[model samples]
Target: MLPNEFSSSPARVSGMDVGLRSHMQRIYNRMTVGVLITALVSFYIGHNEELLRVIFGTPLKWVVMLAPLAIVMFGFNPARMSSGALRLSFIALSVLYGVSFGAIFAVYTGESIAKAFFVATSMFAGISIFGYTTKKDLSAMGSFAVMGMIGVLVLSLINIFVASSLMSNVIAGVGILAFGGMTAWETQRMKEMYSSRDNEEMASRMSWAAALNLYISFIAMFQYVLHFMGQRN
Candidate 1:
């Protein structure tokens, strides 16, 4: 009986690991899709002069720029929302972000944008891998990163009206660091949140939530990297 119990513990642990991997995979798949959607939409709008002008040249641009933030702050309640609703919201947010970001093409050279993206991708991948494989607890670091992000957001808002290039650079630099820390923290959090006992609906909700977290971190990092690395067109 002792031998049987001991042998079965390893099997159970292995099974749990497999489940965790699958859960993480699903989250990453959703995040990849969201990123692709945002990229395609941004590219399309960026390339279309007429569409770009209609969106960015008019008062409606405020809606395009602010809607995602509004929705994320007020409407994104994963606990209250179904998986389907969360999925739709995620897609909608991605589209809104793409619309908001379309102006980047006009502001920055293509080579600069590509370089920034590659750098951001490499940084994100490395940090995320470290977060997942490391044995250390990152809760403290994650908390600090979240606080830094809030401070960055406030500074960014203030800088909008201040219009100081130096301030903008500082904000961008801080944003890149904060978002990089967030990516690592979030990756670890997602890994810790997985459970083999979760039902389909619960699992789906968790996946979407995790995906959104990672997606936001990736996008924020990319934008900040671009601010520093991108050449003005």
Candidate 2:
């Protein structure tokens, strides 16, 4: 007998797979659009030192530093919010990330950034596809990725005070691995969490959660990869 959550009716699994596929597609599409927006904005602002200084200088420094974290808070919230609200949160997060990445364009050569972005894109697509199709459970990787992320964050915070170049590189390297794992793990997670019976509110909230996680992972990985090839001003 099927579990209560899956329904015990004559349709068996019913349209659950169909609905899940559509939901997953939306999540990926939303995340991809957000990444594109962030990249465009970041690339645009990267070339303009005047605008960069305006946004990143003075009191704005605090805002620029904290904005990504703030957007993440809204994006990850699973409080049964509306789809529009969820989507807006994702967009807000993406914009803040783009603004933060603007600094990279100033520091890195355009060619290097382009090369690294392409590499990251290829890697992201491969792993994300694996996550979507693999029948194996990724909950273990998800747990470990979370721990890896926390470690990376702690190391990064320490580097700010230590200002050690060695530690910075180590953190960047680990960041690539951590976020890469997260992208795959989160994709698998979304597949696992999906439910056809979930109302629009539930689906929206969960879908955004998945999309937001993937977005942040991609951005983090892209930045770290760029560091290796960046032309350091």
Candidate 3:
């Protein structure tokens, strides 16, 4: 019996690993779709001068800018929401983000935007891979990063009125580091969260939640990277 149990252990462990990989893949696939949607929407709105002006140049810009945040804060309850509702919420958030980010085209040159995006993608991929593969626990680092992010958010809000270039640069520098840490932390957390026992709905909800976390981290990293690399028009 002892030999039989030992012989089966490897297969069980291998199955678990396969399940984890599949779960992570689903999370990544959802995130990729969200990123593509945001990119396409932003590109469309950015290229249209009249639409850009109508959205960003008018009082409606505030709504476009803050709607995603509002939805995230108030309506992103995956536990209570069905998978369909979660998907709709994710799409709406992505579209709102795209609308807000469309202003970047008016501010930064295309070459700089592309360069920053490439850098951000490379950094995110490397960091996430490390997190997924490393045996070390990053919960402490994640907590610290969350605190740093909150600080960054507060500073950013303050800088909106202060409008100091030095402070803005400082925020961007700190934000890049914070978001980079968050990418790794979130990846590790997602791996740990995966379980074969979860029902289909539960698994789907978890995937959406993980995707949202990674998506936010990636977008934040990209924006911070753009701040440093982007050439203003």
Candidate 4:
């Protein structure tokens, strides 16, 4: 009887594990699609140097560059937003982000971009898988990762005007590490956020946020690794 009970416990746990895997799989699938769309759009623009300059030329460049940031800021605002509003905001942000990413194509060879992207994807997948599977608490790591991300952003803005090569390299290196950490933290967060009681409307918004976070982290990490690989268009 004890042997039967022990065997049944493993089976039950396995069943629960399978269900959780499916939920996480859906989250990843959505994130991956969003990333692919963003990449394609960005690369198309990047490859067309003349088109890029025409749209982002002179005084207009500031608007073009800041558009995505504005939309993302809108998405983050908790007040006066419906689920549909959030979804549209994310879509707009992703497109604008792709446009911003056009510069990557100008900097890296196509083959190198591809290779670096694959590397980043592999790393993101591995960490996220562990985060979803592990029972250990990751909340502490998440807080640290969030602080690191804030530091990276502040430094990146300062470096934009300074154009210091050393700062740029430091930003790239630390940016990769920060996002890598966030990937795991965000994945675990997503797992906790999901539940059968969640309404479709609320879940949709939650999923969009999860997808956006993962997509952004992957793109940032990929760009940094690409820089390290010294990819030249």
Which tens-of-lDDT digit does each residue in 1-233 have in candidate 2?
A: 45764565536555677788899998888889999999988988888889898988778867977977976764446675677887887787788778888888777788888899998899898989988898988888878888889999999999889999899899889888888888988888888788533678788778887888888898888888887867765
Candidates' lDDT values, in order? 0.90, 0.83, 0.91, 0.80
> On lDDT, who's better, 1 or 4?
1
Cα RMSD of all models vs. native, in order, equals 1.2, 3.5, 1.1, 3.4
TM-score of 3: 0.97
Q: Which regions of candidate 1 fall more than 4 Å away from where they truly are?
A: none
Model 4, range 67-176, lDDT digits (tens) per residue? 87777675555235676776677777778778877777877788888889888889888988888788988898888888888999999999989999899899989888
- Assess the local accuracy of residue 192 in candidate 2 as a C-alpha lDDT between 0 and 100: 78
Q: What TM-score would every model get versus the actual structure?
A: 0.97, 0.89, 0.97, 0.85
Give the clash count for each candidate: 0, 0, 0, 1
* Ten contiguous residues with the weakest lDDT in model 2: 5-14
Estimate the overall C-alpha local distance difference test score of candidate 1.
Answer: 0.90
Deviating ranges (above 4 Å) for candidate 4: 1-19, 76-80
Which has the higher lDDT value, candidate number 2 or candidate number 4? 2
Per-residue accuracy of model 3 over 1-233 as CA lDDT, tens digit each: 99999999999999988988898999999998988899889988888899999998899999998899998888788889988898999999999999888988888999999999999999999999999999999998899889889989999999999999999999998898898889999999988877643688898898998899999999999999999999999
